[model samples]
Target: MNLPNKLTLMRVLLIPVFLVFFLIPGIPCHYLLAMIVFIAASITDALDGHLARKHNLVTNFGKFLDPLADKVLVMTALACFVDNQMIGVIPFLIIMMREFMVSGLRLVAANSGTVIAAGFWGKLKTAFTMVTIIAILVYLSFSGDFNSFSLACADTIDRVCGWILTGLVWISAGLTVISGWIYLRGYWKFIDPEA
Candidate 1:
């Protein structure tokens, strides 16, 4: 395996550690630690792609696994937040639906020897989603008890972070939908029933 591929694998490997820190209770500054791991994983995402393109080390394995690793990592974070009642299900569902649609489209295109690279909107969505998740982690870390902070500071932190998080989630979802549409529009030929 090349260096880029190794970084991709490292991102996947960090997911379990992220889960442990985010989900397990009683760990000191658990949210902060989880955020750090997540940041590390996110950095690998950028670094691997840059190195792959720069060094011509891109491989079929890297191509296949990189996106899968990204989706899994993001989904894990969103699902954890949803389960912990930090965010609602609507944005998660929206983002997830977009991903499923895009993935299905990719499968169809791949069947015909086509490869669709991610669009600008997709990249934007990813950036926003990562920032949003990080924001939530920061909020939780400082709020005292990830699950029960709202009860403690229901009037102040809860209201402020809630609004900010909600805005970020919706913006990410919007970008996700737009990106999915861009894919569908650009590749309609592959999935056109009346073609």
Candidate 2:
């Protein structure tokens, strides 16, 4: 396997670690650990693609699995956040619906002898999603500290983070829709019913 593919696999390996950090309760610094792990995994996502392109080591397997890995990691994180009640259901639904729709469209394009690749908007969406998830997780990790006080500082921080997360979620969702449309448009010419 090429370095890029190895990096992609490393990202897949980190998913469980990320989840573990997110789920662990009252670990003193669980939120910080989760944020660090998530950031590292997000970095690997970028490094894999850059290495694949710059080193001329891109492979068919990488092409097929890289995006799939991204989708899985992102969708997993989103589900976990929703399950933990860190984010709203509407945003999760929008983001997940876009992912499913795009994945289905990509499959259709693949069968039609075309590969739909991630564009700028898609990358931006991923970045925003990662940022939002990290922020929300960190907030959750600290919200426990506010349980005793009527006007706790932790509660204030959580509310601020909540607003920021909501904004990021909407931005990510908008970008997801735009990116999906771009890919669909690119593949439209090749998707013939008779073919």
Candidate 3:
């Protein structure tokens, strides 16, 4: 395998490690560790693509596995967030469906000897969604029991955090929907029998 493909596989390998950190409650600073692992995996995703494109090492395997790795990592992280009540189910569903649909379409295109690379909208959607997830993780990592604070102060901070999370979720959801539509619409010929 090429370097880029190796990097992509490394990302897939890291997911279970991140999961262990995220799901294990007794581990000290587990959320922070999870965030760090997640960020590392995200870095690998970017690095692999850059290396593949720059060195003319892009292959069918890389094209197929890279996006799959991305979806697996991001979706797993989002699922972790949902389980912890850091995000709502509706927004998660929206994002998850987009990933799955795009992935499915990509697979179909690949089978037809076409490579459906990511567009601007899809890249932006990924950026926003990753940032939102990371931000939520950071917040949850450092947060303390609000009950220990003065009620008024706790209420104020709670409202502020709520607004931040809500804003992030909505913005990410919007990007997800727009990107998903653009991808499917752009490649309708491959997706639609009548096209």
Candidate 4:
């Protein structure tokens, strides 16, 4: 396998490692370790694509697995957040709903010998989602230290983090809905039974 495909596979391999760090109890700085692993895996997502196009190493497997890896990594993080109460159940279901819808759309398109690639809005959603996940992880990782600050400072910090984290989550959720709409609209013909 070429380096690009290797990188893609490596990213898939790293997901479990990232989760291991994120989920394991009582590890020192495990959240930080998870973030590092996640960020590294995220980097490979871009690098593999860049190298694939530059070196003409793109393959069907890469095309399929690249996005799958991204979704798996992101959804895993979101699931972890939901488990930890960093995010609400409704938002979690919203994200998962969009993912399922898109996956269904893709399966339909594939059955019809068509490939519905990720669009700009989808990419935007992914970028925002990754950033949101990282921010939440950072916030949750150090939230315990909020008690160390003075009352005013703690309140200020809490307010700021709350606004940032909440805004990121909503923005990412909005983008998810938009991107899903775009995908469905763009490929509606594939989904139309009479056409």
Candidate 5:
């Protein structure tokens, strides 16, 4: 109910609006619209955390919901990309696998009365993932233009974007895997094989 928590909720609320803009057909500049919505949500993601720490408004609810909102927002975009064939399935699967591993590790830590904060690598992965999504949306927005020049170089642009996006996906996936491993290893003692 605090400002930071409200911002987190706002980020979550914007996800459906992003989907509406992203998934619906025939909307003028739909990709651009979705990108704007996504960017707005991303800003809130940053703002909430900053405000939470700056003003000492951090709460258990904020801690729980902020990361959950981030994961949901990111995974939803990745799912849309895969469903639309904008990206390959492997990167999506890899990111999702990392999320599952991290979430399970968090559960183990929580049960042991320990809280695991996001590490540097995890933050880097999230930042890179958001930037990649924005880049792809920017590409899509321009690609939808049917200007003569664009039409003439459509294949070339598509090919270039394809390679760039793939590289971005793999880079993000690599970070996710590294961060997941770090989190798991750091808290391995909390996870008991006997349990």
Candidate 6:
């Protein structure tokens, strides 16, 4: 496999490691570890793309799998966080639904001989979503009754983080919907009009 593909596979592999850190009980530094792993995986996502484009190493397989890998990582993290009650159900559902809708649109565009690359808004949405998730995870990691820290301070921080996450989620959702609509409109003629 090429370097970019290798990096993509590495990212996919990190998902389980991220889960292990995020889900394991009684681990003193679970949240910290999870955040580190998540950040590392995110970095790989960027590195692979840069390398692919810089070195002319982009492959059909890389194009197909890179975004899939990102979706899987983000979705899995969001699902796990929701299951653990670290994040709310509504945001999780919105993110999940957007992913599915976009994936469907991508498939339709692919069949029509159009490669719908990730646009600026889509990239911004992903970056903001990742930042929000990371912030939430960090808050969760530190907010428990693990020490003698001021409860009020922790609560305030938690609330701030929650608001930030919620705002980012909504913003990302809006961008996702807009981008998906734009893509669908671009490819509307490709759809089987008779069907």
TM, every model: 0.94, 0.86, 0.92, 0.91, 0.95, 0.89
lDDT of 6 by residue, 1-195 (tens): 999999999999999999998888677778888889999999999999999999999999998999999999999888887897767787678778878877887888788788888887679878888887787777766664244345768667667777877777677667767766776676666675865
lDDT over C-alpha atoms for residue 49 of model 5? 96
Best by lDDT: 1
Find the candidate with the highest TM-score and give its number. Answer: 5
How many backbone clashes does every candidate have? 0, 0, 0, 0, 0, 0
lDDT of 1 by residue, 1-195 (tens): 999999999999999999999988788888989999999999999999999999999899998999999999999999999999998999899888888888889989989999888778888889889999999898888785445564756777678878988898888888888888898999999999999
Extract clashing residue pairs from model 5: none
Q: Per-residue CA lDDT of candidate 2, range 39-148, in tens?
A: 88889899999999999999998887788788888888888878877767887888888888788888887887877777888878888788877776666555653343
Question: Which sections of candidate 4 miss by over 4 Å?
Answer: 144-152
Query: Judged by lDDT against the true structure, how good is candidate 4?
Result: 0.86
Higher-scoring candidate on lDDT, 2 or 6:
6
Q: After superposition, how far is residue 110 of candidate 3 from its true place, in Å?
A: 2.3
Which residue pairs clash in candidate 1? none
Candidates' lDDT values, in order?
0.90, 0.79, 0.88, 0.86, 0.90, 0.82
What is the total number of backbone clashes in candidate 6?
Answer: 0
Full-model lDDT, candidate 2: 0.79
User: Over 4 Å off in model 6, which ranges?
Assistant: 145-149, 192-195
Distance from true position, residue 148, model 3, in Å? 11
- Rank order (by lDDT, best first): 1, 5, 3, 4, 6, 2
lDDT of 1: 0.90
Off by over 4 Å in 1: 145-154
TM-score of 3: 0.92
Question: Tens digits of per-residue lDDT for model 4 on 48-75?
Answer: 9999999999898987888888889999
Model 5 weakest 10-residue run by lDDT: 143-152
| C-alpha lDDT (0 to 100) for residue 21 of candidate 4 | 90
